[model samples]
Target: MARQEPLVRAASAVRTVVEQGADDGYAGLEISGDRVLLWWKGAPPPAVTDTARAAGVAVEVRAAEHSREELRAAADRLWRSSGVEHGGQLQAVKIISDGRGLEAAVRPGRKSPLAPLPELGVPVDVVEQEPPTPTSRCDDGVPWYGGLAIRPSGEWGGACGGNENLRYTCTGGFGVHIGSTEYLLTAGHCATVGETLLDGAGQYIGEATLRHAEHDLVLVRTDAADRIWDGVPGVSDFTKPVVGWVWTFPGQSLCYSGATSGANCGYTVVKDEYTKFCYEGRCWSDLIAAKRKGRFSVAGGDSGGPVFSLINNSAWIQAAGTVTGTLQQTDLLGNKTEWVIFQDFGTATRDWPGLDTINYLDPM
Candidate 1:
């Protein structure tokens, strides 16, 4: 005969223990293979323990003062040692309460008192704290030459590929550096992978390290280089936008940029959507459609470019979402022809986490 499944035995044992409890006795039962766990509060009786023992079940109890980590470790050890293999995964762990277990008491730091858990009359174990927020860093800026500006750091290349002939490229955007090594942020998509992009002048300086991705941010590192100013037009103080930085909205001013477009400004038209522009690609975000008639708007090879809002005669630049264009309509002899119409469209920093990760201090 096949070996008996431990989970089935555990379930049966748990059912037996629950049946022996009085109407107001055992709070609940948790089963894991041949092991049965029961919860109770405000003083449990010996009869509950006796019933569990009769069913060949090991009892692991908890109290409010007990840490969650301690209880979890004990449960893990018990499951391993019981010789039971199936269904040992814990579903949930909760502290049983009778509605009057929380009492407020004041402490030192503030005006509010500390609220501790009241005595639950059960065994509680210590628990571990949640993980910390990830970070990345790049103290010095990257170098730029010709039309290509190389930053010494960037997040992992999630999906990076380019076509030289067509001049189109897409890099799963990564987190940008804000400050020291400890505080870094990046786009959520970039952080999914563990990698970075690097470029150095005379030496191989540093590499891009991904801290976390949920906010679409990454941190990179380099030599302890002081921040430098190139005094170029349109390059806002990385420390802060000039003043009055508003997101793209209807009738609001906007601009498009990239290594190719140079930098052209426009006005906003539409606001939000997964819009389809040139090349049949769809971009999703709060759309900032521009209404400026310029020689060149957004073009290929401009993903992850910065979009700026012109407010109070100052330029406040932020990462524009994605750049797209439209298809132009041409008329010929009672027929209409479709052609690629390149325009500027993008999302604003207000909709992304880029602005929150850094403090815009006066230019240093």
Candidate 2:
């Protein structure tokens, strides 16, 4: 990250100067290698050109053919068709204003695309990088995934599921009930359909009945109902028992529990923008951002853990959702920070139709 920090700082400085002329022709900025890339139209004015050169960082300026607004619209069009399901070739899709117009920054899949990249209506910028390791899956040496209990979110279930010769460990968050059936919620990457799950003590707990990689969620058939809602800790000793949930507001505080880092108490919902979580080229799209000031919002083995907000000084909590993955830091400071990206369980219920209840926390 030694090369990344200077780019971030330089980007901040450049963004201030360029975005001012976005109405004129400044398209956008991107970091490629060790330099900051700026896309703009026409020749630079002395005042603006001098400010950019004085930024004290490496910079690359390109002549953009289209206006910023036109490029933005093109990016939005690509974003809309990202999930059209062309044999899952699109691992991730991001809009970047390029010198020509817009570039769809895509993480290509292992398999080839059924359709051509030009069909997306934007130029495809294939990113070359290694996929993330399966940190949340059950491993023989690491036992960092857990916290199945409702009240304390303590360590109990993690690293579950098995094939003929492989047994993996992963955290199973609190329980949920729909009509007469109960299920354990966790990340889909933890286990596949038909795989059996185990607890921390290696006890048989459930079977993986449902998994949606796009949402990074799995539903395990289990008898572990929601336990007592004794309540989660709050700021300044303001504790409240979680009774129900409300939709996420912009500036609320959200927390989560997991095995590696145990209980992560304080994190602010600083961003609520769309996010992406990819695993080994495969991806789970349509996520939101949850961030804390200092430390990471989540680490390995923390996947599938519940994200909730304490209400008032009481246990009335907002049922946010489960942790998905981390977001790439997009600033110039090279300040690598962790962002706990999650999908709202409230919005997720639409996928599970005919269900009597969805994401309802069990009472003690």
Candidate 3:
């Protein structure tokens, strides 16, 4: 865990420079095994490199083809022009972490006219890939912790509108406080505002108070605590206290839990600021992508579960993000794997200012 401090300090310095609009040609930043890699389109900025060095960390500046801002603009233009074309064939779009170019994922065997899009100033690398689908999960308990299964009230065990389809379930995310109101976090696509959430045993959990469909995040005002279930339901029941939240860096290790899949680890961060096209022609952006190592780490009904990393190999944990869905990507060997994608808590706090996980920092 101590190895993360230098990476954190270096990231802070780079973030400060970008936030201040003094990034120069900065493209992105990543933590690669205790070293900070800063990608820039042209000459590396002395300000950011010097600041990061002064923070007592090793920093490497690499040349990039395009800046993050440029890639984002290019991606937006491509989406605007080709999002609804060919029945929404475009699956996803993101800036290559190494700043090589923009990556546009389209449905396999489908033709998309993405190359001639006007105002797409940056280079685009098109690939055939399937779009990710939203997943939703569980446990039993009080003070309602994250990773517990929750479903819409009145639809959990029954069919709605004369169909045998039961309501889809979702896993609770982190417990957060917006002002004095306590709320449980979950995937917005799981339920709508004003819908009452219930546990598997038919107990009232809370009512969805806030929903952000674009980011796939929802807040439920309820009785909750700042902890995540550490054990799998029907097997064991334990929890770890949430100390605070942390930003996700590529190559960092993480673990996630859901009612359907329980807890799975050995996941590595792959990318951030990804925009995935989902059902109903919608696209959710600013998502973090983590690759699974072994057996599937995510499945249907795992949406809104907690994604975190252990702190100092102890029971305490730092909040990372909330599961959104899984993406299918092919490797150089042409092997396809389902990757767990999540909405970063950092984006959550930014979207809802003053929002924070109910943690040890709170008053007793």
Candidate 4:
């Protein structure tokens, strides 16, 4: 219980703003370290600040003139307006700073240089970032070690793939419902409905029956959910079932475990929402991203893995979401890095309508 004190306090303060209604300029909320961030559609009213200032935890109130979704659509239109060759290679789009505007990325070194985004009555910035290298990942086979497919005998997080010859593996946060229904959660792009999920030893476990691309999720139906285990290679111990999960925050500490990689710990969330990514030329928004504080966050085949946070010194854990993809970035100085992308459980919950108790791995 003591472990939940800070988060409990933050949630209370956040509710204070959420309860105020849209008339008060509050459009969105996210936690940032010790503070709760209340993003208003315009300048924050005095009552909002008064509530934040007096709250036990620190608070940040900012303005976003328009909702992030609106800006996301506007960004899409901006890209379409370009209509030039360069726009075709553009990777992703996202709202920037206080939701005041938008930013986009294009293939590095513009052989087909793109013009500045036309006036959209909002701040817009176009930057250069390399498009992820597109290479054929599958051709009549799948990697058994990817996506942390389950292994029989009560261990999990092995590899799950597609039924088509073009199999691509991805991991999902495992869960249980009722006394018999079992499920595995992951990104929609990882696999589709009816595809069989395999374990470490290549035994069939379940099939994906639900998916929500807008939410970046795919839910697989399984027979039994005994426990949630992570495929961290060489690490025998892992967390047990999830106790709970916190909302995404600007600077909240978080971690993840993928089939391509083991559990990655100690990183800060850059922003909570309104993030965007493109898959196979289809662009989507509303995602979470985190940087690598100690090690790389995620990679291919790691999609649909677990994004979680720990409490009580690893004695308890919470499931945030399944891995979506990574944001491969190239800074102005040409320095390249990648951050893990995730779609939290709050969104995944939509796929399963009334299911309770999300079972996730906890360190033992």
Go through the candidates in order and give each one's C-alpha lDDT. 0.30, 0.51, 0.74, 0.57
On residues 1-364, what C-alpha lDDT tens digit does candidate 4 reach at each position? 2343465446545654554452344556666555566676866666666666676776676666776556666766765665233355456666653566776666668635665556777676667665432101111112121124442223333233332322235554646453356566667766667777665455565787877866777766765342344435334424345765555655567777765565777656775353456655655456777776333446656667677776666655666666777766555776766677777666655456654444444322
Q: How would you encode candidate 1's per-residue C-alpha lDDT over 44-117 as one tens digit per residue?
A: 46655555556544555433332323333333343233211312221112222221121111112422222332
- In candidate 2, which residue ranges exceed 4 Å CA deviation? 1-91, 94-146, 149-168, 227-242, 270-272, 312-316, 328-336, 354-364
* TM-score of every model versus the real structure: 0.34, 0.54, 0.86, 0.74
- The C-alpha stretches of model 1 lying farther than 4 A from their native spots are 1-192, 199-245, 275-288, 315-364
Clash pairs, candidate 3, are 135-303, 136-301, 136-302, 136-303, 137-301, 138-148, 138-149, 138-259
**Which residue runs of candidate 4 sit more than 4 Å off their true CA positions?**
1-24, 43-56, 79-89, 115-118, 132-147, 150-168, 176-181, 224-227, 234-237, 272-275, 279-282, 293-297, 328-336, 359-364
lDDT, residue 32, model 2 = 65
Q: Per-residue lDDT tens digits of candidate 3, residues 14-123?
A: 77666667776778888898687878888866777667778677878888888887777777777777665444456777777777777777777775544454557677
Which model, 2 or 3, shows the larger TM-score?
A: 3
RMSD of each: 24.9, 13.6, 4.3, 6.8
Off by over 4 Å in 3: 1-13, 16-24, 42-51, 85-88, 111-116, 137-141, 157-168, 280-282, 328-336, 361-364
The candidate, 1 or 3, that scores higher on TM-score is 3
Q: Judged by lDDT, which candidate is best?
A: 3
